[model samples]
Target: MSDEGEMTGGEDRPLDWANEPHMSSVDTIMWRGDTDRRMRGTICMLEIYDCSPDWDRLVAAHEWGSRMAPRFRQRVVDSPLGAGTPSWAVDPDFDLHYHLRRIKLGGDGSMRELLVTCEQLAMTALDAARPPWEGTLIEGLPDGKAAYFLKAHHALTDGLGAIIGLAQLHSPTREHNPGKPQPPSPDPVNIGPLDLIGRQIGDEIGRIPHRVDLALKGVRALTNPRKALSSALRYGRSVPRVAGLVSPPGSPLLAHRSLSWRFSAFEVPFTDLKAAATAVNASINDIYLAGLIGGFRIYHEKMGSPVDTIPVAIPISVRRPEDPAGGNRIAVGRLAGPVGIADPFERVLTIREQVRLARHEPAVDIFNTLGSVMAWLPGTMLMQFSGAASQNDLQASNVPGIPWDTYVAGAKVERMFPFGPLPGCAMMATMITHNGTACLGINSDGAAVTDLELFAECLIAGFGEVLALAADDGVEPGVLRRVE
Candidate 1:
């Protein structure tokens, strides 16, 4: 078939040939209009990098998106789906421009203008008719570097999935193709309340036998009250230890969050942070938070508002092998990082211990389950309240990376930095390792972190100090260095 003919046929087909969970399950999970307005599924963030290609090249590169099937590539659309499915599902009627937008920000644009543009771009609502994904060719990056801002709903992909998608769109080595067949148009994605209810009914029916078995098992276990009590005690004991890492409400260190967002970025040589982790027997995440604690120390100290403690909420991934990879599969864990501890090693050690202990807490699962339950509320309600409550200080996430080579548009991805949302807090720091470099993306509240450049400088300095301490403790200087 001709290229246009193939594209036309693909767009007409129902996405049934692709993966279809019960339509109800998808409806429940997709981000709904209510949630979109309040919390808005605008959870994803993007960083524009300087590439050597012209505008036409970038647009042509994306045409590959429409040639694939829904299973291969589809955007999510919302319908009056029920609670069982996600609110976002594959959009069969995929329109190229709906996902790709062009914006020029030159005439008198400043750095602030770029940020405002990004935020506004973030706010531009996704078309419920097509899939919930977008790519904007962002020109006018400072220093003449053209950029692209690609965003998808949080319901579509998490950190890992986003990285993977970017990798697929790129190639390890450069090969300029004049043109390629377009990817298939996606199938229709819709979920209504009836779909949710039906899926729940099916789930209940399937679980009857297992639930019965679980009930009998529970009864037997309850008969052995001593064992159960012992297990409970063991679990309870693990909480207070990690309490420093995840302070519950009422902790003095939890800072106030505002409505605005601020952003800054820092690059730490992977070799350095890895050495620090080795010295302290901490993971890269532990050191990442340590660096954050160090930065917060500077931030609060400059404000003359330093506190002895601050609670950080760390989102922990809880996806099991059997779980689907697409949707949210993570949980949050609160830990108190020692901001007051002047000594870097002491702070790292404290974080290490608390994080270690937190692994055993039953409450961690309870909190995660609570988030899942809350996700079921009307999207509008969930967005409004979740943001309202979460506007507290600091969100730190550590997403694993592909240890091997990965590419985008055939450009060798020299680095990957992650920029997470800054809700109500003063700052959000995210770390991702790309080609062995630890790229840190920090989005600060413009008002709260007034001097974005200075904050970025502090992060750079603090990382050096932490790395020095790690090296002093006998960490090999070259262990974590990037291969590139």
Candidate 2:
């Protein structure tokens, strides 16, 4: 969103990130839940470029970006006792040198080796004291190519918001634009833990009227007791499904969870994936889940630990066109993945129906509805209280990408991969279609996926099955390739 109170199609504007001083109840949980090391909420993005952007220009771009979007210069200050939501305050000790880093690969400098470095970087937790984000420029690839890695807390902004934030900072063309507007740095605000607690108190006090209004609604509904009772029962039945209190059959093989993380990359043509989805009369999301679930089926069969179904989790975006493009605006949706289904078309069909039902749950918005009350709970107990995603084997998300070409400093971005956090899940798979390719970044628990080689092969073959469906539509066969 622009500072002028409206969003321009593609013009420069202040981002709608961290605009508010206090964190929302939902973001508070995400930030505090880091108490459980296994449920780190770090999200990362890796972008490959045709060539290394000029170092001087790159630094200048970030400096300008920090001023335009002050959230980059802010840090999370929790309430005194972690009893409530935190506040976003400008860091008094902000230092660009600490957050921005540059490194060069030493080995053959293959994409595979680069990913290994990324995995190590991702495994290192960000300092909660400082602004919960960092960036690195990795040079020395096979050609003149380079890559950039950006990691931030999930409380900062979601995958979609990150792209929006990126679009504002990245240049539309390779050549430097001397006439770009410069925005002043946001004034520093001294916000401490005690102040945050008071802010939380004020927010809670502010919600009394809403609560009272809801209570009055209930009282009025009692006049039509039968209708009210039916609505209450329907919502009550859906609460478990939305909260993940109900778990589906699990795969014994992917049951383990650990602190160690490993990374794998894959890409498929967007056109082909969409075409295949259309061929099956399903949405792209269904096809994506089917391919992922199909891969699990192949992997389990190969590992001699076949299962009929496994619990799958996907984020159901609750973001609206009028909502601010910041933080998370999503709810969890669970599915009983049909791994037993041998046919790709059948798997897609089954997944499509399951997704439809999950979205239509009477209480699909339960989390957001009760986040205020839940946020009051101490951080230490949030893992158990929040019904952690640990019960699921896979957590996947699909985010719309920046459709046009973009450059940072002077280098044009080639492929953009997003690695989502593994909040107790065996794997977090995120797909973002950059340009025409759907770049899939999978962050797996090191112990859960013992055989990375086999896992990658199975995923490729699984996607191959789904992509074949497009052949009947006169679409060229799309090939899913493992990125190094």
Candidate 3:
């Protein structure tokens, strides 16, 4: 699903009209990660209340918003000879209606039905020929309510970038008015295979000087015995740390995976979570990881195979202030969750300490640096590397979101659930805070995570255990709420 926002510095300024934007190295990796059966896409589900939005107004709003973000009207143009990274070219045949769809729920229009519909949409891969996004308006909910499901390719944006794009389509108040229609999008240029290869070769040749300069600097450093010794010492010390960044030994039960996916969602009160974190002297992220550990432990025990620990990949956002708003700037850090620890408080404390030390390790910097290089590799090699990187049991991420209540085209948005890609992992759990509540969306590989319903119940029970820990700190248990 996609939202509307411009690249940094593109707002209010006229389009270059001379050159198309180049996909970043990180984005290129995401693009290559997409396969025919398994598409790496991010789905955002927003439940709106009161009434359905006017179709015409919503379309116009999207049009206006897309004008601000030209990437919405562009498609990735890969180099014909695999000479360089892909480029973003304007899609001359871009159709607003094709990307924006409307569907009506049958019968009572229960939330379960809505989610099922969303699951189908999520499973269907986005068309690579056009822009990599589609927004669906789901109508016919109880009490005149409706929902919007926005699906965007992972190559287009990360979690934070998705939030920023969505903000452009919403308003602080219902009285806001959408402005006039914008000008037409630019036409795409047609470049033949020979031209594409020439352009790519030229680009690579242009980098020769920079490469030689770096090589000379490296030679100079090696000539200095003291500097070379220091560098060798640093490398030797970081060898183990770099190895630790890869997946650790995990439960064999969740080792097998399939292309199929199952999405589960639940809500927890933010205040209760904050209290629990405070009681343990940890961050909200620590509490989140702790809860997952507890849940996984319970799940394994129920399956008659309790494990000691599980490795989880945590995405660390490395976005800088000057980075554009709608591209990826994230690195993965693997952590061994102490699920063997029976005490919830003790588990949280252990996780907090582990995360604190992991962040400071030189391995994380090395991992990020390698990630940039991996993006330029062949798609098959990158996929192999990604498969190895995602060998961990689960991936947990916490993306900060809009704090205030928001409205989309005059409809009140009650909840926002973010569904991240499973990415060969057993499960991908992501949480976002919206309007005083922590909304968690869990996307599990259906083949690996059998009995998703029971797993969801276990997650709720896990959070209950954490909230119980917070009770000693004077936080009321009643503040915690669960939605399955």
Backbone clash tally (model 3): 3
- Ranked by lDDT, the better of candidates 2 and 3 is 2
Worst 10 residues of 2 by lDDT: 1-10
Counting clashing residue pairs in each candidate, in order, gives: 58, 0, 3
- Please list the residue runs of candidate 3 whose C-alpha ends up more than 4 Å from where it truly belongs after superposition: 1-20, 36-39, 176-199, 202-217, 220-246, 366-368, 371-373, 478-480
lDDT per residue, candidate 2, 1-484, as tens digits? 1111112243454566557677777888898878888888999999999999888888888877787688888988877776777888889888889999999987899989999999889989999989899999999998899999999999998888888788767777887776665667777778766677677888889999999999999999999999999999999998988777787856779877888889889999899899998887989899899999989999999999999998898999998988777788888888998999999988999999999999999988877889888888887777876546457889999999888788887788899999999887888999999988999999999888889899999999888888888887888768789998
Candidate 2: list runs displaced more than 4 Å. Answer: 1-13, 387-389
Candidate 3 lDDT at 118 equals 80
Stretches > 4 Å off in candidate 1: 1-41, 45-54, 66-82, 87-89, 107-116, 141-144, 177-186, 189-196, 232-256, 321-323, 367-391, 402-407, 410-412, 423-425, 447-454, 473-484
TM-score of each: 0.78, 0.96, 0.89
Q: 173-259 in candidate 1: lDDT tens per residue? A: 455533433434545656666765665556658868976996798688788899978867865764443323224342233344344
TM-score of 2: 0.96
Give the candidate order by descending TM-score: 2, 3, 1
Residue 110's C-alpha lDDT in candidate 3?
Answer: 79
Model 1: how far residue 411 lies from native, Å: 4.5
